[model samples]
Target: MFLGIDIGTSSVKAVVVDGTQRLIAAASTPLAVSRPHELWSEQHPDDWWAAVEGTVAELRAAAGRSWAAIGAVGLSGQMHGAVLIDGAGRPLRPAILHNDGRAFGEAEELNRRLPAIGQIAGVPAMPGFAAPKLLWLAHHEPEVLRQARHLLLPKDYVRLRMSGSLATDMSDASGALLLDCARRQWSPEIAAACGIDLSLLPPVLEGSAVAGELTAPVAAAWGLKPGTILATGAGDAAAGAIAAGAVNEGDAFISLGTAAQYFVARESYRPAPEHLVHSFCHGLPQRWFQMAALLNGAGALAWAAELLGKSDIGAMLAAAETAFTGPSPLMFLPYLTGERTPHNNAHARGVLFGLTPASGAEQVTQAVVEGVALALADCQAYVAETGALPEQIAVNGGGARSPFWMKILASALGKTLHVQEESGAGPAFGAARLARLALTGEDPAKVCTKPRIAAEIRPDPALADAYGGKLVQFRNLYRAVKPFYQ
Candidate 1:
């Protein structure tokens, strides 16, 4: 058996996979985000560990003796989070998450100061990336920055607690904006610009490599064997791609998790910063992926559900689907937490235009769904600008559970969307596959084959044409509001 863990922004998930790649047991624990100030998103590093413990305990209870058969562990997690640590390897403060937009000014300054960062780092400096967050710390909290001894991504921090090691994978490290992505190494120029030394970063390794062994104390407490190997793992997006068997060139997928991504595997390093697409190293060696990443996805739906006093998101989507006719009467901009890819604007805010006295919850819900779809359409267009678009696209994550939203997305993009079995378990399942690859020395292609498709959603011609018109308005609306945002 192999253990796969994913430290998501909203939860920590763990899964147990047997020798035949069957998911025998799985569990998850919810997490909370602290937003003490506007545009700030953070979480205590210890909370993640506690959540991991919770999930592991549940899995152990469910899997029984199979837990002891675990050969290796692999991790997948939300990327670009900045977790600063002191010399004692203790967190200095709460980690600033990928969606935190407080460092927009710093990000802009970074781009201005180092014009080559866009080409070298695979994407232009963005507030969500680690380097800009560190820059923010340098200017606003210099004392903390001065005292910090190490910086780790979210999953790497979790790995440290499990294995007492400081290391990271190239796929995760690439999002930090401090890596020479094409070279798969830390960039001294970028580090200097962020007021951080190369020593502050961890040694980068491939995702499938053994990063460290489970420490004896942690192993004993977690009811695991001593010296269990921990694979380097990957960022959530890369891990999801691995699960979808989207590692080969031209393979593509759309992830609709807390945050969303439109990803395409690339054969080599091809920076497409001009299109605002991320060109980063894939989990597998000698491969890279181009992505148009969004800061909001099912999270937008959850927020809307809470706002509308709807406790059941499924019910909300059902209501919205029933009310949907053509395009929504109201247009919603789904930038509640700002946006990336194409726009790259951290100041953008969500707006519901054309709402009237008669508009109700269902209309608003439909508009929100349309808003997210339109945003993803923008992502598809920009990703298309980089290279030839993939003919087949896999859809996964929390939002993919809603066939209504999948239909909306299919029509909006005018393409078929494949929903595979266990789509919601993507990252954790991919992590398990990586663990298997590390333990058995198997070919990743064999171990990471795509799961069986559960459904295929094809575009509706009438809705597609209507969405095409709405997509034009969506783009125009963002440009019109851009000047007003600071």
Candidate 2:
């Protein structure tokens, strides 16, 4: 058995799988994000550790006899989070998350200082990236920078606690903007521009490589065998791509989690920064992917659900399905946390138009869902410019559970959407597969096979036609509102 742990924005998920890739046991523990001020998202590193402990304990109780057979632990997590650690491996402050937009000025400054940053990093220096976050701290909290000895991404920080090692995988490290993405290593030039020391970064490794053995103390406390191997896992999106079998050229998947991503796998590095597409290293060696990410995705739906006094997302989606029929006259701009992909506007904010006295909760809810679909469609259009459009897209994440949303997404993109039986498993399952590869020395292609397709959503011509028109309106709305954001 292999174990996979995914430290996500909202939860910590752990799963155990057998050699054949069947899930044996799974568990998750909820996590909370703190918004101490507007445009900032932070999480306590201790809370992540506690959540991981709870999740592992749950998995242990559920796995029973299978627990002892587990040979390796793999990790997957949210990318680009900046976790500052002192020499003793202690967190200096709350980790700044990828969704945080507090470093806009720093991002601009870094890009200005290094004009070749986009070419070097394979993506523009954006506020949510690790390099910009560090630059922000250097200017605003110099003392913290002075005391910091190392920088680790979210999952790597957890790995440090579990294995007493400071290491990260190329897939996760690629998003830091300090990496020479083409060379698949750290770039001293970029680091110098950001005023960061190369030594502060962790050693980069392949996703399937053994990072460290689980320390005896952590193993003993968790009722597990000592010296269990731990694989250097990947960032959430890359892991999710593996789970969906998007490891070859032309393979793609749409991730609708806290953030949305249109990910396309490639055999070689292909940078398209002009379209704001993110090109980064794949979890597997010698592979890369072009991705267009949006800051808001299912999280936007959650926000709308809360505003409508609904507690359950599934129920809210059902209500939205029955509440409206065609394209919503009420258009929503899902820039709640600003946006990435095609438009790197950090100042953008959510906007709702065409409100009427007769409009009710249902109209607002449907519009929110449609708005997200439209934004993702924009991402699809940008990715298509770089290569042939994907024939089909594997849909996963929280939004994939909703048949209504799946139907809407298919119609919006005018492409068939394949829903895997293990769609909800997301990155955790992929991490488990990576663990299997590490433990068995099997080929990643063989170990990370795609799951069975439980269902498929095909676009309806009528709905597609309507969405096509609404898409034009969506673009125009953004253009009209662009000036105000600046």
Candidate 3:
């Protein structure tokens, strides 16, 4: 059996996959994000380790003998989080997450000061990227900067705890804004511009490569053999792509997790910064992908559910689906934590418009779902503008479990979406595949095949015109309210 661990924004998930690629057992532990200030989002490094340990124990119990037979391990995690570490390998503070918007000004300053950074780093500097957060720290917390001995992404921090290693995969490092993505190495120019030293970053490697081995102490505590190979894992998005077998050129998938992304695999590095499409390294060597990322997806629905006093999002979505007529009269902007792709507006806030006396839970719920779909529609357009849109897209993530939301999203984007079996497994399953590769030295092409298709969702012709009009209104509303965000 092979093991895969995904350190997600809201949880840590671990899965055991047998040699046949069957999921033997899976476990997860929930995590919380701390938003002490309006635009800040953080999680203590200790919380991540705790969650990983909790899930590992659960997986061991569930899998029994399979746990002892584990051959290799792979990791997948939320990308772009800045975790500063001291010389003794202790975190200086809470990790700044990818959704945090506290460094917007720093991001803008970096872009203004270095125009070539976008081309070099794959995506333009954004508040959510790691380097800008470092700049924010340099200006606000110089003491922390002075004492920082190393910088690691969220998963790398977990890797350090697992194997006493300080290394990162190319796919994850690409998002840090300190990497020369095309060259697959750290860019000294970019690092220096952000007041970072070259030595602060971890060594970059392919996600499938064996980066380290489990330390004896951790292996003993976790009931695994010492020196078990640890594969340099991927960013969650790249790992999800590996799960869907979307590694070849033109293969595509849409991830609708806490954050969403419209992704297309590419054969080579093709930066399209002008269109705001993210071009980054793939988990596999000699591969790259373009993505349009959204900071909210199911998260938007979660927030709406909380506000409407609905404890079960599935039940709420069911009610909304049952009451669905045409497009919702009300409009919602799912920018609860600002946005990433296309707009890059960190100050944007969520909005609900066209509310009336009749607008209750159903209306609000439907609008929130449709709002996320419309935001994805913008993503689709911008990605298409760069000539990378695929004909059939695979859908995955927690949100994709809702058929109603899938239908709404399909209509909004006007594309056929294939819902694969085990789609909800997402990145953890992919990480397991990477683990298999590391153990057997198998060809990734053979190991990372697409799962069986469970269903296909296409656009509803009857609701096409209504959705088209609503999409227009959605764009218009954002423009009208842009000044308010500033």
After superposition on all CA atoms, what RMSD does each candidate show versus the true structure?
Answer: 1.1, 1.0, 1.0
Kindly report the root-mean-square deviation of model 1 from the true structure over all alpha carbons. 1.1
The CA lDDT of each predicted structure is 0.92, 0.90, 0.91
Model 1 over residues 157-220: C-alpha lDDT tens digits?
A: 9999999899998889999888898899999989888877899999999999989999999899
Clashes of each: 0, 0, 0
**Candidate 2: segments with Cα more than 4 A from true spot:** none
Q: Tens-digit lDDT track for model 3 on 16-98?
A: 98988888999999999999999999999889999999999999999988899999999999999999999999999999999
Decreasing lDDT order of the candidates: 1, 3, 2
What are the TM-scores, per candidate, against the unseen true structure? 0.98, 0.98, 0.99
lDDT of 2 by residue, 104-222 (tens): 99999998999888888888899999999988998899998999999999999999999999999988999887888899999999999989889989999999998998999999988
Query: Whole-model lDDT for model 3 versus the true structure?
Result: 0.91
Q: Give the TM-score of candidate 2.
A: 0.98
The ten-residue window of minimal lDDT in model 1 covers 383-392
